[model samples]
Target: MKLAELEVNGVSWSPTKASLPVLHPTTFTVGAGKVLGVVGPNGAGKSTLLRLLYRFQKPQTGYVRVGGQDIWDMPARDAALCIAAVLQEQASAFGLTVREIVRLGRTPHRSHYATSGARDEQVVEHVLGFLNLHPLADRDFGTLSGGERQRVMVARALAQEPQVLVLDEPTNHLDVRHQLEVVSLVQNLGLTIVVSLHDLNLAARVCDDVLILKDGHPQGFGPPQTLLTDSLVSDTFHVDARREQLAPSGASHFSFSLPN
Candidate 1:
């Protein structure tokens, strides 16, 4: 899939006309093939911002553009062809096998009366292998572990051949190894990625740039190394954060304590 730039220009949203906007006018850009990490405390509107990017929800005040074209102006199917999302909530597979579930990603590319063609099968097979799910391709999706299921969801998204990928809390319930694996996979995808993550260290490690949110307002936006300072973390997350560099890799890491 060709990489595309993602732009959010002063986008804002609210649940109803009378409700206060859950997301204030927010703006950011993810360059072609770059990974942008969204980080914030719960209810800070990270997911709200992501929903706007993937066209799951329309903004009240601004435009979400992909490759310089407004997504709201495109057909839903056309938008799906360019952008794919792996949401935080896993979908029920209804006893479907892994391959069957992954095959569903091809829906946006097919006509209503069209059957699964050779190219669709090829793409599904390739995505399964790319995510190393070949061993479980025949297994019922509901029978897999949390990490395995997460990988399957990712494979399904990959099968879409999307130019931009949006993942909402992709590593939510996984163990340490699986979390690292997911982070590594995302970093190597070579697609424009917008991922919302609660783990600040993972965001710092995998993201080219980070967008910090607090109470539905943008707190900061820039490279993580320069933007995720101790003071910022403390104020936004309400934690005492200490930054440390690992011994051999010299990567930035954080340790947090409850505020005194």
Candidate 2:
């Protein structure tokens, strides 16, 4: 993966021609190697927005550009070479092994009727070892626990060797340890990533910049320290959020109370 810039320009989407917009016009930018977190309530179009970024769906009104190229204008295979995404859904383990799942990431790199090559194998092997999935390589993907499965999903995405990775709720369904580990692994990956998160605290720690979405529109966009204020959280999320500094590190920690 290499440094890449991502830009979404006033994008919006609707499920049907006559339906209300699922996402209102919104825009944001991620500089090279920066992590951007998308935070929003359910149906806020977080996933829908990600779909546009990765070329799964095109915005009805605006456009997404990666590395100065419009994603919609790029060929599907070309887009996959630059960007790979992992959504909340996991591949069913039914008959596939972990290694097989990861190896599938090379699909974009393969031409029609082409089989896996030595280079593809090398890439898959390296990603397996990097993510500590080597031990599970031979195991059935379905047998792994929730956290382990998420790691495999991430491994698959990494195997693509993309310049920009988009993940939707990557931390979902994981316990505390795995959640932190996943976030840490993502931060450590020396590439640009756009991820959607439900946990405000985790988003604060992982994101260099945060895009707060409310019913398809941006409520705020900036560094977490500047954007995630008490009033913003209270008004947008309807939670009484308390910000606290923890230990000598002075990192931010937060607690919340429901509105009375």
Candidate 3:
């Protein structure tokens, strides 16, 4: 799939006109083939921002543009064809095999009465391989482990052949190894990626840039190296954060503690 740039220009959303916006007007850009991480505490509107990117929720004030075209102006099918999302809550796929679950991603490209075409099968197979799910292709989806299920969900999203992929809390429940696996997979996907993550260190390692949110407002947006500082973390998360360098790799990492 061709990479697409994602742009959020002054976007904001609210439940109702009178209620305050859950996500205040926010703007950022993810270059084609780059990964953008959205990080914030609960209720900080991280999920709300992601919903706008995948066209699940329209912005109340601004435009969400992908590849320089406004997503809202495009037909929903067209939008789905280019943007795919793997959300925190997945739809139940009881009795469906892994391959069957992945094949459903092609729905946007097919007619209601149409059978899977050769191209559809090709895409599904390619995605299965890309995500290393070929071994589990015929396994019942309900039988997979949490990490395996999450990988399958990612494979399903990849089957859409989307230019932009949106993932919300992709590593929420996985163990350390699985979390690394998922983040590594995302890093090499070669598509524009917008993901919401609670793990700051993972975000620092995987993201090209980070957007920090607090109480539905943007606290900062820039490369994590310079943007994620001790002060910022303390202010946003209310924890004492210290940056440390690991001895073996000399990679930067954050250590947090409760404030006195």
Candidate 4:
């Protein structure tokens, strides 16, 4: 259930000969029950790294491991069982109902042409309840608004019962409240999560660790307070990160100040 000493080395992905690499050589590790925040500019390969780790594409070199075992060496089904991904584009293309789409999360555990048993149903119910999706469970997937659809995707991923949850731009279409709710749910799950986020402040609030990427390479990696500073933000994001302290808890937050 924990990822210890995880590393990705010499990993590159190129679709065409002249096409630039999606992910250049990158290496980093995340511990268990901790959230890793990935931040970068538009083309920093944050999504590419998530794809490589989730086996959407094979790495040209190096490795991805879970618990000291090479992920590629593990059976694909087994890997799917342990790692659940909630990608930005995983919308229901088939017009499936919300509950039905979420139930598909159990596919990795199914045998040949098998149906979901009572346990799978229980998990699906649990996930919907956890995400507060019971009110919308019977809705058609395509009929939901962007934020609603996004929550459905999160529920699906949670229904898989994975130890490691990977989210790529999960808050892309969400409003402020939904964003906080979805992030809170993920944080409370106590799962090893690697979430690629464009909003650096949200990352600081939700994640325990951080990895900064620029042009498909690592710019920095560490705790949020250490990595989310003014200089690094200015360098990687080309903007100043101004700090402010919140009330009561007095937790620090940041704002992006534009260049003159």
Candidate 5:
């Protein structure tokens, strides 16, 4: 499925009618079936952009659209059906079991207070299996480790079967193995994945394209190989790329030099 161009028109948000300038009235497009990394320094409007996409906050001056359709114009449920998000914050668990938490994703497809039908059950099972959460399906939501909890959140999002999956720092608390597993799974799914990442190397490995946000505006957006150059990494990310060649792997890897 093609990701309709993401159109943003002078989108800005402010509190108390005074502009905070999280996003500086920027406009851009993120293509489909590809992962776009939103990378920037702290407080650069990463989450704000995500909130705008999910309609968690209204824009003061502009609009956001998918498939040429205004995201706000569509019903909230419809938007939910099209996009799922895994944010970088804790969600209060209702003391629900893991299975029950995942099953919540079926809500949009079901009537109010409707039971889980056969297809819904199958989808839930599939998601659990995909995320290797089947073992913890019966566990308490609050008891899982941070990585496990993150995986569960992703599983719940996957259960929505959305065209676009937006994650904010999805690898934050995971060990190396789980981090790789989750990102690789996302890649294999071929969904239009828009995620904010702090790790440039991980972003390079997973995302086909990258969107750099600096000072709450578009710095660059293109293929990783094209946009993730040594100079760009040094300037935009404020880190030096120590380029080295791997003897066995025969590939170049970058290490960051700490700032003076």
Candidate 6:
């Protein structure tokens, strides 16, 4: 697979509210085989940044590039072949089965009929296995639990065989176990990934690097251990938190408490 560095060059986007900006001249790069977590509280422009990465929204200025080529310059189908996204606002596949939902990832590789060939079916099966989804493959997607649906969405993205996977809040609406499972699954994917997460502890464990954003401005960017400091976390998230290195892994973790 041709995984390339994902780069955002001084991207700044202004929302319809004339005086506000969702992203402010923000720039960062996600190296190949790295997981970069965009972490911040709600309305921190994390989602907006993901949208920019996947070409759902254009920046008022600057650009997003993968493998040194501007994404905007590539054709839609060409871009899809390189980047696959699991977004929060996607339409629900009410009547589709899990296998069929995963098969949608092959759409770009097919004609208008969107039918899958043998190889496509194999790819779907592989994805289903990768996510340990064979048991639920025939179930109606709408009937599955939230975590199951999220896994199906991820499997659909994997069906694309993308070099870079982009996800927005993949763990939302899931229990603690499901959240950890989802993050662990993404960590093992071995692709350049850029995910937006609200949970800093998960960000610290899963992200190779963390980009902090607050009120539409770039706050800081580095290895989570280095940048997710007490000061930065408190200032950006407004929560008093403590950082500690885990016993065996040396991975950092945070404990938060609200100020009285």
Q: Number of the top candidate by lDDT?
A: 1
User: lDDT, candidate 2, residue 123?
Assistant: 95
lDDT of 4 by residue, 23-88 (tens): 777777777778899999999989888988888878876788866777789999988877889898
- Residue 1, model 2, lDDT: 65
Give Cα distance to truth, residue 229, candidate 1, Å. 0.7
**lDDT of model 4, residue 173:** 77
All candidates' lDDT scores? 0.94, 0.89, 0.93, 0.83, 0.81, 0.89
Clashes of each: 0, 0, 0, 0, 1, 0
Off by over 4 Å in 3: none
Indicate the worst ten consecutive residues by lDDT in candidate 2: 86-95
When 2 and 6 are scored with TM-score, the better candidate is: 2
> Which candidate would rank higher by TM-score, 3 or 5?
3
Predicted structure 5: lDDT: 0.81
TM-score for each of the candidates: 0.98, 0.97, 0.98, 0.91, 0.89, 0.95
Candidates ranked by TM-score? 3, 1, 2, 6, 4, 5
lDDT of 3 by residue, 29-114 (tens): 99999999999999999999998889989999999998899999999999998899998887788799999999999999997779
Worst 10 residues of 6 by lDDT: 13-22
Q: After superposition, which runs of candidate 1 have C-alpha atoms over 4 Å from their true positions?
A: none
The reply for model 2, stretches above 4 Å from the true place, is none
The deviation in Å at residue 100 for candidate 2 is 0.7
Model 1 misses residue 210 by how many Å? 0.3
> 62-98, model 2: which lDDT tens digit per residue?
8898889898888889888899998898756678999
